[model samples]
Target: MPAAVVDAALIVAAVLDAMLMAEADRPYAVVSTTVAALALAVRRRLPYLVFALTLPATAVSSAVVAGAVALYTVAANTRNRRTLAVCAVIYSVSCAATVGNHDLPAPTRVDLLVSVGYNIATAAAAMFLGQLVQARRDLQQRLAEIHQVREHEQQLVAQTVLAQERAQLAREMHDVVSHQVSLITIQAGALQVNTNDPDARTTAQTIRDLSVRTLDELRHMVTVLRASGTAPTELTPQPTLAGLSQMIANSGIETRLDGDLPTDVSAAAQRAIYRTVQEALTNIRKHAPGATATIRVRHDGDTIEVVITNTPATRPTVPLPGAQHGLIGLRERAELLGGTLTAGPTSGDGYRVQLRFPATTQ
Candidate 1:
């Protein structure tokens, strides 16, 4: 109901309680009864305040009901131990005042005790029921909060698992397919130079042969990575740092490499570095075709750095389409080895990628 309507209803109830108190032979009935009735207006919001206001006026029978309502309100809305203790004291006082006011004979005193006991018991039951309801509400709210937190944690876990799986797949593709395709490209180039028939002579023949071999190796890698239908070791050879130079050469891009690389680098780090170099070259082939590229690897005191750069092409560069997680995966791998990777367009408009990996001292 609207505020005006609720206030009008409260005014009517207070007038009725005042009139009822006037019929009794109580002293200061109107003033005391009006105050107790007015307290009911804010009983639920301020339960203990209502109990304090109504307890003094509870000498009158009409005000006794108001005190009981206030006690019920406190039990329903609050779980404070002090509030409960105060209500218990008020209830005992009200019960004593009610029994003392009644002028009964000795035999009826037993009846009065039974009636007062039942009334106190009934009031206690209401307070207990309200407290039970409040406890249930609090438990439900906590459960909802816990469930929401669990769902948020589950979403984070799922995203992390998906990211790790993508990185692992990228690593496998670079390891198995890149090296095999590079070998096929080199063998095809040698054949092109030795073959003499114009009909049989095709520059595209080298790319086609390499792509076929790459597909076969990719299928085998997929089977191994699945692990459910096949053993991981049954797949083809796992490449090491030795295959990186050939990978850079196979994409029909001119390249230069310098410095002796550590062959003993961990297999995981080696695969990550090879993939980084291959991705850089593939980006060059797609974005800066016909541009000469250089990949330089250097071993510092406790770090290994790989830098790949290419000259700007005559045409504008277009980004390649894929998962777009290649560079992100490379960065993650570098970070796992306590290193870093950077990729961006150079000042001369060519693309450049640089990566650093920390070496294990042992």
Candidate 2:
């Protein structure tokens, strides 16, 4: 029960019982009873003193409500069994002797024994009730501590699982992507050696050099992932809007990017825009050979939008094996950030990829 209700109930019970059973005809009796009952108001702060104050009422009349309540409070707040035992005995004695002290006829032996036993039992009952309340409080505190430990264990388990998953991703990047880039480097080297045209040889040498650089960067990324750190080690700077022009230049695609993005755009949003454009350029390289591309990034009210359009292939394109996972991953990322991504064939037999997400900072 709530503390306020318990206190109110105790005070009300003591006051009503004292008024009903205390000797009202005698002024001293009335005063003692009233004081004893009121003393319970401070029982929690001064348990022994309150119980002592209640003794006069318990000794003179059958209204032992205040003494009993005060004894109960003492038991609940204290753990000293010896002190509690003495208090219990004193309260029992006071209740038993009340009958003889009130100018009644002297009681016989059996009646006296029964009266003493009953008062002893009452004192024991109050003490036991208080002890029960204390035990319940202790149990609740223990359960709360156990709950906190379980939460900590759950967090540790989650981190362990994340580390395992990151290790798996690093393995795939090294095994699959690294092998392909190495083959590209070798093929470019062969082309550079066998070709007679100076222009073709120069192009092959550029391809070989770019492939080697990409492989080295990929290895650096894989090493960082394999270490399983919470924050990635910055082996190289993360790509941002500032690097977009250079990225497009290195992609070997004839593409034009127009429109301005705010300098204060959020880092995650800028990275998303960079990756989306990079993925679009990769698709065009494989599926739309000789296609000229245009990219436009704009801020429309609260929206940050980017659109990539590529003309249809100008020459016969090789059928490259693809599962379109890049676009699927981009769509999932957009959804995670409360955004949308759409891609389809344009009116001029071209392809278009558009992304829209809530504008950040800017």
Candidate 3:
């Protein structure tokens, strides 16, 4: 819009200067003015061409307005230093021609000096304004590019911080959980050998088995967290529904297992299911010891569901220190596998943890 306005103004100035101010004959004035005015319309698109056309017209009939406008447009639009040099040469030649016009009366040295100084000043001002506009536009473009680069760098910093935090968390879990589970396994092994009753021996063995498996998984998780590349060859395979029975038996809570579970779920879905059940059992042991729990796994078309519920604790016991991040971690795991988890108090006097996942067929 501003370019259109500039073109209109330049055309009008050219026409008025030729009609009112030109001392040339009517034919030469008309021709020069028309050519100069028409050239201004294409100044933005073809600034060089417009400047070339107006230079000759200005020289022939003193159409200074059109030539000045053309030079300004070329300088403002063209980044090439050579184009500016050419404009300075053309302007100098036109000013020399104006000063040396033989038809005009001979001037005194003082008057000639004043005219030359004024012409130089006017040409310098036009060029300076054009250069100023161009410089401002260039600075704005550079600032915009810098802002985009800053935003990208900030995103990279955020991701780096998050990765570092995750690695630190994995190390802490290994140090804490691995030590506790190892103690349990050692005690359970001792109990199994010392116990006289067959049922007591069996329960102790189950505890030992579960503790060993949990330790394996804990070690694998620590390795994964610490590793920046592919997993180590010694890393244990992830647990699935096949190991669900061992988890329930070792839970030490009287848990009733039901439902026909599928064996061919995706590895990610399997990990989510296993972790959900493990967290539920751990919570039961921590908050509701000696509670009667039910473990239900169901397979419907395109979906698999697992629900673990425990009745109220019979004996009140001292609560142990807990970070209370188990359910939060489980929710993250479930969502990663395109699954959902809901854990809360049951309708009755109990707690329930439910998990659902999209199933993969064999």
Highest TM-score against the true fold, candidate: 2
TM-score of each: 0.48, 0.58, 0.55
Each prediction's total of clashing residue pairs, residues at least 3 apart in sequence or on different chains, is 0, 0, 0
Model 1, 1-362: lDDT tens digits are 78557645754665575676443666665666678778788776787788787766665453455666667778878778677866766675665565454455543767768856766774687588768878988999999999999999999877666655544664556544554554454445445656796545586474656565564556455445433221111123555688876666566778888777787788767866777877787666556755888888898768888999999985443332333445765776677777899999889988889998787722
lDDT tens string, model 2, 1-362? Answer: 97678777888898899889887787776887889888887888899999999998898888878888988998998899899899999999889868686666788899899999889998999899988988998999999999999999999878877776666566445434654565566557667878999999999999888887887788677767767734221122446888888778876679998898656677767767876887788777667867899999898768888999999988666434444545764675566557999999999999999999888532
lDDT of 1 at 101: 48
Q: Which parts of model 1 have CA positions greater than 4 angstroms off?
A: 1-27, 102-108, 188-362
Q: Model 3: per-residue lDDT, tens digit, 16-80?
A: 87776566555765686679878889988898888888766666665678877888887788888
Question: What are the lDDT scores of the predictions, listed in order?
Answer: 0.66, 0.78, 0.72
Which rank order by lDDT, best down to worst? 2, 3, 1
Candidate RMSDs in Å, in order, are: 11.3, 13.9, 14.6
What is the model-wide C-alpha lDDT for candidate 1? 0.66
